[model samples]
Target: MSSWEIHAIKYADRNARVRGDSFVFDDNHDAPHPMDYFMWLLRRGEEVILVDTGYDDAEAAARARPIRLDPVVALAPLGVRPDQITKVIVTHLHYDHAGGLRLFPNATLHMQAAEMAYATGPCMCHDTLRMPFTADHVCEAVTRLFSGQVVFHDGDGQVAEGVTVHRIGGHSRGLQAVRVRTESGWMVLASDAAHFYENLFARKPFPIVVDVQDMLDGFDRLLGLASRPELIIPGHDPLVCKLFAPGVADHIRRLDPGPTGKVPR
Candidate 1:
């Protein structure tokens, strides 16, 4: 089997209250929460595939989110320069996910067809539907489209010898997760499909959802693709850093789906 190394590079983090209900439907549990923002990098020899280009400094200021490091900067430790990137698999087009597209001038973007339609179509007429997306980010995608820099996929397919992207819309119109083959096994990069393991295991859904049912179903789809529940990585959970040791450089983790030490309570 093809072997690849996967790393979750945390660029920023936030301390906010994730109302239990904000992430769970019909639940009224209010609590303080810490969330981390990341852009995943998959490497096989010299080939590189980046999942989701994280938001830039401008977005951090506009959204009032603190950014510890830029996603592009985070890649330097791994020795991956933007120009070295060949393909970027966009899980979704939210500002935090697709805002940094311009950073990679040499990469071809891989996105879902349904997600493109949802981002560009009439659904954006509603403010609630468009709030999570940035107009400039969407516009950048349009420019990429015209320049033949964007590759659209309908459903699940291989991105490389060991990388696969699965379409499981829930948090957005065409949300997808990446499944990668590693020395440990197949690891699913469940980007926003389950922002926190608590959301998936506990059956709680994130409030910013397009189709609640799709989000709910996405959890199942994630499980199916990953096979083992623990192999799936949540998009915004700080526990990822805790469970996976940091790489030689800061904020980088090499995922290994093996026995873990005692987790802090």
Candidate 2:
């Protein structure tokens, strides 16, 4: 078992337009807007793993959209510099998940092979499909791969001791979630596999899914992989911090520092 410290980094905020009926197959109800987020650092021994880099400040600001906060600025309180990150586990290649790759030059990125192909493949030729990501960000990741800064995962692989990556295709063909062994048991970081806890608890599916069946299947897999459903953390749910104990408050929270090592609470 490896001890770990997990943080819920608040990179950007959005009023997610969700359809109530869509989540429940009703197609007649409305779900309220919810918050968007990013995962921060996970420190274990000498390795520091960063889950996702929130949006780049300038790019997000240029959209002239309302954002609750800037991810970089949010990291200031924690004193985490971009280059200090040793590894970055990209949950997916969406603009929100992969936008901050340039921030850490020394870090080796862990991502799904299918995600890379999708972000840079022919499907992106269509405006509707490419609208979710910024071309520049995808280009940056491509450049990083060429420079040998990325380590692509073909499927499920162990990133670190007790930290496993589980491939679940739903939001994207290569979308994956991270499962870390915690003191309490196993905690699943359901990155985009299920955007909100309600989706899993209510047995509903989020509308913006690439494959509806795959998303549903992924949810089932997530539940089986974890010792407890409460340990599963949704990618975009703001309630994560509230659900888990506070170890590192401002930037991220420590869910459980397993038997591997101790993180000062």
- Give the best candidate by lDDT: 1
Q: List where candidate 1 sits over 4 angstroms from the true fold.
A: 26-28, 257-259, 262-265
Best candidate per TM-score, number?
1
List model 1 lDDT by residue over 84-169, tens digit each.
88799999999889989999988889999999899999999999999999989988888989999998888887788988898999
Assess each prediction's global lDDT (C-alpha) against the native.
0.86, 0.75
Off by over 4 Å in 2: 16-28, 247-251, 257-265
lDDT of 2 by residue, 1-265 (tens): 5667676776666665546623657454665656567665777766678887777776676665454566666666566877788788989888788877777788888889998888888878888677767877778778888889888888899899988898898778789999887767888889888787778877788766777898989989999888777778788876765655554445455666422322111
Candidate 1 has which clashing residue pairs, if any?
none
| Candidate 1 residue 13 C-alpha distance from true site, Å | 0.6
TM-score of 2: 0.88
Q: List the lowest-lDDT window of 10 residues for candidate 1.
A: 256-265
